[model samples]
Target: MTSRSHSLRDAIEEQIAVGELRPGQHLDETELATRFGVSRTPIREALIQLASMGLVVIRPRRGAVVAEIAPQQLVEMFEVMAELEAMCGRLAARRMFTEEHAQLQAAHDACREAREAVDSDEYYYRNEAFHEQIYAGSHNAFLAEQARNLHRRLRPYRRLQLRVRDRVATSFSEHQEIVDAIVAGDGERTAALLRDHIMIQGQRFADLIASLAHLSNKAA
Candidate 1:
């Protein structure tokens, strides 16, 4: 995340955000270098970092391509994300300290500010902070690390859904439910709600994919 790498990342993420570098599209270093007004070194490094976040795949023969996120992968990730977050909530309920609880409250306040501003993207980022706060509050270093890795992997999809059909407001509501459960130390409710919140996205994605498959078959 140095100055140069940050610039490259911004350029790359812009392409992704605008749908220029779409799913399964190859990332040509020469073309990317030309686009970002830099050489191959920074582009390569940026691609590697993005790949680590599950955004791209760097292969030998074809180089990097935007990762093809399958419906099954989405469903699988939703399952894993639910379990990890639930684990965090359960542990946090049992182990959260005063300072950690205060941090969690601060993060929720950030989410509230984003909601008031009606900035969904900002809401999404701050929502991540809120979840990370709970994870760290769990006091299980290993579980926190695992949840973080999964969270990063799901970032792109999560952001995409945030812009879909008033999902931002819906997400805020879910966060409120989670916070209540955490404060009450209601482990069972926390786990179930987290699972439902995550699995709902998977169900939506499945329906979307199903419609696409039908349309493709009809066109064929």
Candidate 2:
């Protein structure tokens, strides 16, 4: 896609992630075109890309809107995502090359800077890169692809969770331990840490739901 399309996609994705655009809110292409001072073609392209990422839904008669996933279904997706990430960590611990290890460390360092800045949005993007390094280190193409696909689907919810109080700091701390485990070639430990890092349960789940409800209320 063109740079304009990518820019529009990221802008809309951020709005949805931060709850500025609530679930099921209509995403009219014409309005988006006017709002962004772009042509409808770019707006439509951006919406289509977002739809592929599970952040938007395109309907036959209704055009497009923000995707609305049921709470229970969201939980289920997180559960699977956690497992996929854990597996990636496990394999990465044993399989990563020396160069891959260095790259992972660099990604983690970037995340640390984001955390120190206390910018949740920056940290979220850095954190994604850190996890993706592990996925690449897994040395299993199919597994890596599956993890990436699910990760994209869960992007909005995952990004939303980081906005919770001190979540970015906590996430960085977790990443520290995860990196240590993988570097030490402790597959099981890495797996466990990754699972805990990605899993949304207990209070984390509650925080996510409350945030979503707040956004829905605001939209209403």
Best by lDDT: 2
The residue ranges of model 2 lying beyond 4 angstroms of the native Cα positions read 1-11
Clashing pairs in 2: none
Query: For each candidate, what TM-score against the reference?
Result: 0.81, 0.89
lDDT of 1 by residue, 1-220 (tens): 5679777876686566444566677889999889778889988889888887777899988799987777777778878998998888888877787777778888988999998899977898798899888889888999999998887666666666666666778888888888888888888788778777777354568554554454346545
Candidate 2 positional error at 12, Å:
3.7
**TM-score of model 2 vs. true structure:** 0.89
Question: Which candidate should be chosen as best, given TM-score against the real structure?
Answer: 2
**Candidate 2 lDDT by residue in tens digits, 1-220:** 8899999998998788766777889988999999899999989999999998888999998899899999999999999999999999999999998899999999999999998898998998899999999999999999999999898777778988999999998998899899899989999999999999988889999999998887677767
